[model samples]
Target: MDIREDLRDVSGQIARLLALSNVFAENNKYWAHLKNDEDFNRVYRIPEKDRYKVESIYADGRDMAIYMMDALAEINFNYARYPTLTSIIEGFQNTWVYGNYNKETPDIAKEICSTYDIDLWSVRQMFKLFKDQEKLLAAVRATLAMLQNSNLYKEENGMPTQEKHPHQINLTGINSSSININSDGASAAVNQTYNEPAVFSEIITAIKLQGLDPIIEGELIDNTHMLAAGHKSGTFKDAYIDFMQNVSAHITVFGAFLPALSALL
Candidate 1:
């Protein structure tokens, strides 16, 4: 048995494992951020004199990534079910860097919510608007506020599940003073005044902050992405049509505004 061949085979396996991990990371937009190229060079402190040490550092990284992805997949699967408080979160032990989840939603998600006495359907609806963790959390805070303010959902003790005030909307850093929802469910009314004139820069900033990637000028741009126009009413009209037809958010505030605006026009 050639020992050199065995060493080469081991190196190849490590390389292959690392390559697959990278592909998965990219495909999922999963930024593991385990460490960057410079960090590896600095930590290992491999001198230029010993070129062979490079493979050793890479092999170590390969092993670390394998473990990181494994943990991330497990955690993400758990979060996929969300809207429920899980003891699993307590058990987690994150290191300096945090792992992201992007795995097939576990079959137990529904069951997990059921176990926690969480409303599965409502949770789904929440996720429909708030896709990521941060927004989801903010929305949760807002929903609890709605529930508490509704004068409904009272336990025998008569305590509130959601506290009043601290109501957040869109949570993209715009906490408008006028936007208030104290009613119940979708019918909950937002009773406030809007004397502040619409500032173009503010609207544009808000859109960009959402990472909506708005196109300002008319171009042969793909109709899929949301586009804004300075001129060419045709392009604007086309984009609006595409958005309305594809995005079924009629229940959303912005969605409701579209039809209302159309009627007014």
Candidate 2:
């Protein structure tokens, strides 16, 4: 499998989860089936495959897998997003077409109609003359190119300012849920603990599995510039917050690595 492609797909899920984690939208199925573990699993299951891949860091240990699940389930994230909506869309326009805009590249109809006072019949005729007529008649769509980007990195000491930013790095691991066990003799509840050491080990192994050097990744993250909304018109804090949020979604894979992301540091 292409690692970058996989990462890009994973990144989209993180973005959605970041938006839905605390959502109260009545129609959202995430909350609708949340009480039914099976249903919740169904809705959130697409990325579970990726989680299984990450679980390889544990080398197929059932206990480690259990711990990993517990750790993920317990996390309450202070999520952030990167390449803000503005930046990602801008990047799309810039790259998708020379501009190479996929959808934004204006259609012949729009460009020509704007300059002429032509009637509907004339407009239809004009379109018939254009080659690749189907493309010329296609609907407007945002390429959203930033979604495929697998290039993300961070550097030491260059982290965004502490007070203004949410705890992007200083994650909190709290086991807020519990599982009930019923044995022949008795029933018991267990509080899953966040095993920092285990999580740290897994993170290192998982990153390496991508064939990336953490040291180089750190540098790349620090120096890289992806599109982020609000940066052009907003304060540094706003831009940083947007980038960090996107990063949160990019790395978390729903809930597997979050809260324990503190282990990354």
Candidate 3:
């Protein structure tokens, strides 16, 4: 076997895997930190060498948790300077160096988060996001694998090449904050203010009892993934219409937003 060509094929599979993982990292609340942890620590991002050794272990369920933690630590450290996400964005630096996630800057992330008293709760949130993202990631990975096995792409050096799938959406960096699901538009409410959902749920019930048809937004059971009321639109029919139209234009856009998937996953 031509090792280079064989490795190329494997690399393609890995890239697709990473892409799916990336989507999960973006969509699923838990995976976001995990994914961020992975993304932020790329080899180039490391200021000092010989800190982290990035390797591809088996892409199995057992390793998922570990990967997620890695990304969480990476993000906390990278974003330590700013208190808010917006401030971090405004002062964004190219820490991800060529998209390589290798360990660097020994205990740098730990030191930074420690200074701010940021604990593993941040990692916990990412795990919550992972729940939903996992489903979509699995679906996409299966689809890609099926295509590759069926010879969908042109073979060069006997490796599967990237193909433009009809349902492709660049979900690499999209986050819960990126999409605005407010009570004014959709019945879906995204609440991030409270640490516990029971309190929020009681508040929501009280609001609903008032006949406001309020859509509450906040961290759901998983704590990382954002959950809203089902897509019923309730008193917000106009928001529902807009949501439907947007979905019709590009369903993949809403793939990550479905309450059904969120509920089941």
Candidate 4:
């Protein structure tokens, strides 16, 4: 069988599963309040016909989660040709899927917030944004498309191909700090001192313009803040590059600000 086609099909299935999970979560806000089957059945009184809806949603989510895990494993088996795509899927699995699928929504939120050092409200907003923007789904589809094109080029030429660097954005006259794209196609390098705060502000503003609130939809803001903090703490440039790579993978809308953020490196 053609592994690339299989990967593409599985990725599409993952997108549909994610959309289903998002819809289930949105419609059942009370899912957050219950902890287990006992709690679920005890907390609410519904007609007999609808009694199984919540249970069914959880069961379906768990089954889909398992399917996603298997798909990622299949992708991982071909990691040499698709390292970037594998990393993106792995990140999504670890952060959003994995052990959280069968659990209550609050449990999922708690785990994410504790791991990322963000708040519960931000977690909820992030999920809402996930549903509205379908960012992760878009990222998976784009990465798969890139991989397929790369494969076609390789096959036609009968030559192995190197992975391309992440897309770079160049900003001129921006405080003399610039990330110069390498002529050899390596990742860019920061050359001068730039206004880090302004760059972060611009990114936050860009996120807010997408109809997210500073206080409510704070997950993206928190992530941007962490990136800023990492720079201030003298973290290496590679860390920022890695973060931006993941950001670009997930949120295509923030493409314009990548260079500014990369400049902080």
Residue pairs whose backbone atoms clash in candidate 1 = none
Cα lDDT over the full model 3:
0.32
lDDT of 1: 0.28
- Candidate 3 lDDT over residue span 130-168, tens digit each: 333343333332323332343323353256656644322
Better of 2 and 4 by lDDT: 4
Superior candidate under TM-score, 1 versus 2: 1
TM-score per prediction, in order, is 0.21, 0.17, 0.21, 0.36
In candidate 3 the C-alpha lDDT for residue 29 amounts to 47
Candidates 2 and 3 compared: the better one by TM-score is: 3
Show model 1 residue runs off by greater than 4 Å: 1-24, 27-52, 76-87, 94-265
Give the best candidate by TM-score. Answer: 4
Model 3: what TM-score? 0.21
For model 2, what is the C-alpha lDDT against the true structure? 0.28
Write candidate 2's Cα lDDT for 1-265 as tens digits: 1222323433432332222221212112322233233222322222443333322212222222232223222222311322233333233243212123233222433343344432333223223222111111110111122233323211122434233232232234556432111112221111232122354335434545564467544322321221111111112232233334544533532256544432222
Compared with the true structure, all predictions reach lDDT values of 0.28, 0.28, 0.32, 0.43
Model 2: lowest-lDDT 10 consecutive positions: 134-143
Give the least accurate 10-residue stretch of model 4, judged by summed lDDT.
Answer: 130-139
Error of 1 at 247 (Å): 30
Cα lDDT of model 1 by residue, 200-264, tens digit: 22333433444443432111122112222100111223223333333333223143244322221
Off by over 4 Å in 3: 1-4, 7-13, 19-63, 67-127, 152-265
Query: Runs in model 2 with CA error above 4 Å?
Result: 1-196, 211-249, 259-265
User: After superposition, which runs of candidate 4 have C-alpha atoms over 4 Å from their true positions?
Assistant: 1-44, 78-134, 152-175, 180-265
